[model samples]
Structure formats: C-alpha cells, structure tokens
Target: MTEQPRLTTREAAQRLGVKPETVYAYVSRGQLSSERAPGGRGSTFDAREVDALAGRGSRREPGTGGASGASGELSFRTGITLIDKDRYYFRGVDAVELATAYGFEDVAEWVWTGEPAHGSRFTAPQQFLDAARLAVDALPVHSSSMDRLRVAAVATAAADPLRFDLDPSAVLACGRMLIPTLVGALPTVGQHRSGEGRLARQLWQRLTSQLPDEASIRLLDTALALLIDHDLAASTLAARIAASARAHPYAVVSAGLGVLEGPLHGAASGLAHRTLAEVLERGGAAPVVADHLRSGRRVPGLGHRLYPGEDPRATALFALLGAIPQAADALAAARDVVDTTARHTALHANVDLALAVMSVAFGMPAEAGETVFAVARTAGWLAHALEEYAERPLRMRPSGHYTGPRPPRPLPA
Candidate 1:
C-alpha cells in the first residue's frame, strides 16, 4: 500500500473551497489537525482531514482518542427512522393505520405513555395541567417549543407537591400533558382550580383554532407517527440520559428538544424547505436539479443514510402531501424528475426532502417545518425518556489521556 503525499494548508484550502484564513481558523480550532513537516517549516495538513472539517461546519468538534486500552463508541447514521426488533416494538403496530384513524392526541399518548392505541390523553390529573399551564405562561413568547419546555421543567419541579412521585409511570404522564402546550396547542380556558379537563380534548379544541381544517389535524397526526421514536439515535440517547437522571417529565422533554436542534438529527427538515424553495424559484424540478448537479450541489430530498432504498415514510407522506391541490403541479413536476433523473440513482424520496415540498405546498411558514418536526419528534423523545427512567443511570464518564510531559516537580518553581 502507498502512503498519500501530504498537502500544504494552502492546497487544502483550495480543495475545501474556503479561504486560507478559514483553513487557519480550522487548524486553530482543532478541527483540521496539522503535522510538523520534517524541516519544521510551514504546516502541512492531511487533505482528507481538511475536506472533512469543511463539511463538519458548526457541529461539536471531534474528540481525541480514549484512555489506556479504552475504546470510544461509534454510532451508525441511519437517517430518519430506526427499527430495533431486539429491543423496540415498531414492527408490531401499523403506524400509518393509526395515524389515519386517530387524531394527533391519541398518537401523542401512545408514544409518550405507551397507552393502548385507542387510549386517551385525558387521564392526566388536574395538578399536572396546572403545572403545564403555569410553565407555558412563564415562557417568553419568543422562545421555541424546546426552550419553553425547560422553563416548564423548573416550574414543574417547583410545583410538584409530591416529593416521592419520581417513577417512570408518573413522569411519562407529565410528558403527555406537557407536549400539547409546548408544541402544537395550549389549553386557554382552564381556571386555576378547575377539575381535570381532557388533555387530548383541550389539545384538539385548541388545535382546531390554529389549524381549523380537518386535513391539518390529519396531517399533523401522520407527521407524528412518521417522526416518532426512531430507536437509539444520538438525540434519542441524549433524551434517554436526561431521563436516566430521574429528571422530571418536563426536564426530560426539554433535554430531548435540545438534542433535536442539531442538523444531523432534526434541522434537516428546515434545510429541505430551503432546498425546495430554491428549486421552485428556478422554475421546475428537472432544470433546478440539473443546475444543482452541474454546480456540485446536493439535492436534499433524494438521499438517505439508512434507506439506501426508498424510505417508506417518504412514500407515505408524499401521498398525503400530494393530495392537496397546490401540490399537484409541483408533485407532477417532481414525479417527472424522478422518472427522468433515474440516473441520479433510483433513489426514492427521503422524509426531509418530501417535507420541503410539503412545507411550501401546505402553506406552512419556512420555519414551521422545523417547528412541526420538533413537535412530532418530541413524542419519541418522551418515549426514550421513559425508557431512560426505567434503567439505572450511567454517569457517562469516559476516560482520557494526558499527552503532556509528566512530573517535572518543583524544579520550575
């Protein structure tokens, strides 16, 4: 095997399509590690490392190796969804069937509390509702749903009169109550002292106000089923860790939302919307894709990490999104591209790419795609949070190395 020749930082910058200053910044930031060439002259960097650093953008900078004889963990990127037959139960239930027949509230409870399919979210006690409302009101309206939940967590912790009710079952109920207020809708009519209202009913009643049409509720329901509970994803793991801490339902949910804000997990929906908008601005799908390919651009909806084949969720949602009248022309255009661009890979649409088209066709605000994803994915977070609470907590202490010289003692002093 041949060892590849190293490149100067200047050459690496040219390959990365970034400025020389950006390349230097990457080095200083420990993103693009450099080698001291034989003469100890100007730095040389690995070309592959520089290329990777350019794509990494603003994510958590990569960590160095583990301590003596210890290995760090690596997770495979299975985009959008996960099916864990050994541990999880997605295979047993028909998600599309439930999404179509039930309203969003039923699915919400199903994911969070693992209640029966037809079960109600109304079972949460009045005290939980009171805590949720107080938390919602305490939020700065400018905050996202994820942010509002953290505010709710502190309020929930402050208000929970019960000192000993720290188990998974109780905490999960709190999650169901919290979701409606944080993401989709909030109950407005509650008296500070009213008896327990239907959590599902109040949510649906409020949802109808923001999204009056039946179709929006249906769409919201489908979205939840599609996005909920992908197994053991990084964001899911973060949620689980928070849950393992016996964080109250509010804290656990907040933690999950925080994890979802990352691009690798959750921000792809918004990016897809951006991609779709640019394509539409260019007229139709074919020319837009052709131009993008010619310019070395990525087409958002056309690829996935998990399903090298067609994503089942993407096929399902496109059917729902395509039914709307405004989507007809664009949907037709997309299909035409799919047929003609078979050369682009027999790739079927992935969830985010389909969602980009749906966001525009459904008349959702550009940011609403992410907002909706946060809402849908919260159900999965709660489920993982509940799972976390059931397990004994791991303190997540990983070992490390000290590369510096050892024990110089008081000689320097």
Candidate 2:
C-alpha cells in the first residue's frame, strides 16, 4: 500500500491563505485536524483537508466552533478556555477579572483543575531545584530562557521516579512542582532574594534588572494570568499530541516549548518588542509603521486574526499599565502604533504589543515577553495535556491525499 503524501504546515497554511498560527487556530476551533509529524517535533495537516478548506471559504468567524475541512466536517470540544465576543474566559470566569483579582498560581489552579481560586501553595523539592539549576547552567550563555527551560524540563523528568504515573492526582502534583522549579533555576538580573511571595514576584526577579514596586508586580501578575490559556495554540496542540501518546508531563511541556519557539508563535513577542523600541527611537509610531509598510512587511504586534478588533488581553493589560507613571511613554507609543496601523490596515494592538510595553516599562530584554508567555502558557499546556490523556492515544493523526506524479510511471523499473 502506498502511503499518502502529507503537506507540511507551511504548505497547508499557504493553500489556506493564512499564517501557521491561524492553522493552529483552525485546528483548535475544529476547522482542521492535525497529526504528529514524524519524530513528534511538529504537526502536519491533511492535504485533502487544506484543499477542502481552501476550496470552501475557511475564513469563518473566529470564535464559532464549526467548519468544513477534511472528512466533510470539523468540531472541537474544550472546557479550558474560550475566546468569544472579543473577551477571554477560563471555563466560565472572566479572564480580565481573574487577572486583576488573583496571582498566577491561583489562576493556574483554576485553569488546570477547574476549581475555584483556592490559593493553593506551589512547592518544589529542594533537590529538584538544585538539579534544575545545574541543568540550566549547562546551556550556553547566549541561550534564551526558553532554551534553558527545555533543558530543565528534560532534566526534571529524568530525575522524577514517578514521571509516568498517569493518575490525575499524580500528574497535577508534577505540574505544581514544574512551574516553580523552572522559574527558580534561572539566573536573576536583580539581587537574589530567598523565598518570594508569589510566582509572579519570583519571575519578576528573574526577568528585570531592577527591583519592582507593587504596581509593576501587579502588572506582571496580570500579564501572566492573562496568558495562562488561549483555546489551543500550536504549543498547546503539540503538548496535547505528546499527551495523547501518553508521554510524561515533562515531555509534554518539552513538546510545547519546542513548538513555542516558532517565530509565528510565542517568539513573535520579540519582533513586537523590536517594533515598539524602534517606534520610541524614531520619535513616533508613524515613522516606524511607515517604514514597515514601505518595506512590504506586515507590522508586528498590532494585529491578530483571532480577535475581530483589539485583542482583549492587550486591551486589559494596556489599561492596567496606563495607571503606572513610568509606563506613560511606552503606553503612548503602543497606542500610536495601534492607531497608525489601524488607519492603514485592519490590524489592532494584540497581546504582543502589551508584552512589549511591559518589557519596556520594566527594563527587560527583547525576548522577555516570550519567556513570560512560556511560563504562563505552561498551565494551559498541562491542562490540555490532561484533557488529551483522557482520550484514546494517537487521536490526532491526519490522513492525506496522494498528489505526486502518478507514482513516477513505475520509477524506471
């Protein structure tokens, strides 16, 4: 039997006239189904599905949960997070309210376990922290935080004797330790302090070169909470694909980290940061946006396909940052970027804009936004992992159509 040829994600995205992330969004919304590409590094879509979605208008409303892809129908069910009417929800709770009212630990519990905000304490064994530090330090000095994070994940998994304990309670226990241990092992820019109050505070120490006040801390906390989950992104889907194979929690997260490194995914924040910084240096948003247009490049950070208008997460975080005096210039620049882009294109300020503003306000690196996104989205990844673990294994394999030149006429036998 001849194997059907599959389309790489980029090919599928091209056929659909959408970006790769939009392909993932279509998968999340049940407009498509993806299978693990060989070696489990990424995903491949059914060529027939792409052809079908291309034939039909795959550009349905973003939040609606039905479309016609392969197999003549598509629908996905998830209890984790929802993006509808330009707002985000966890289960049924308002994400903006959760961001304002609780820390990331509490938000993680809510997103992962669907329990009310119970304020559960996240604790890690001392030995795990020690091992994670060694693992992190083994990376090259130029490595990004996500690079170190991937290393730490594998090392932690190797150290855990019960990593394959697929029981719900056991998996949740592993998640609790994974988040804190990953955060604590990284080198800090500020003076090291022992025993932080919340996950956000500890993460703030790792990210910024200076001490932070309550307002900045709250802003960071809101950023983390807001990023906890977003339906099923590429990273989340990768995590779920690993989980469907019954891979351990750490392996699941490693899969997510690998996918998140894509520039179109989590690392997009870095590009957005660069854009905002250029806007600031050029003295206004108009010039930078003009340069982007003249270069025939899409303006980074100002648009998202998922949101009909401004991304709600960016809107909420920008509103919070407007309260901080230090954030005034960054906030104004972001607004100008948004307004300028809107005048020329259909783009609006997305979460990447908010992340750039946060990094600028707090004196962090360009990639700091990606780091924050990685940590916060870990919760969502674990949640999706659990959901996939409950389903049958290898559930996402996409069948393809053969499109080669008629088997090469027997290949010159």
User: How close is every model to the real structure, measured as TM-score?
Assistant: 0.65, 0.82
Tens digits of per-residue lDDT for model 1 on 156-264? 5566665236676666655665555453224332232322343333333432233324454455557666667666667777776676677666666667777777766
Which pairs of residues collide in model 1? 301-353
**Top model number, lDDT:** 2
* lDDT by candidate, in order shown: 0.58, 0.84
Give the top-scoring candidate (TM-score).
Answer: 2
Model 2 lDDT per residue over 43-109, tens place: 9987878777676545443323333333234334578888887888998999989878888888898
TM-score (C-alpha, index-matched) for candidate 1: 0.65
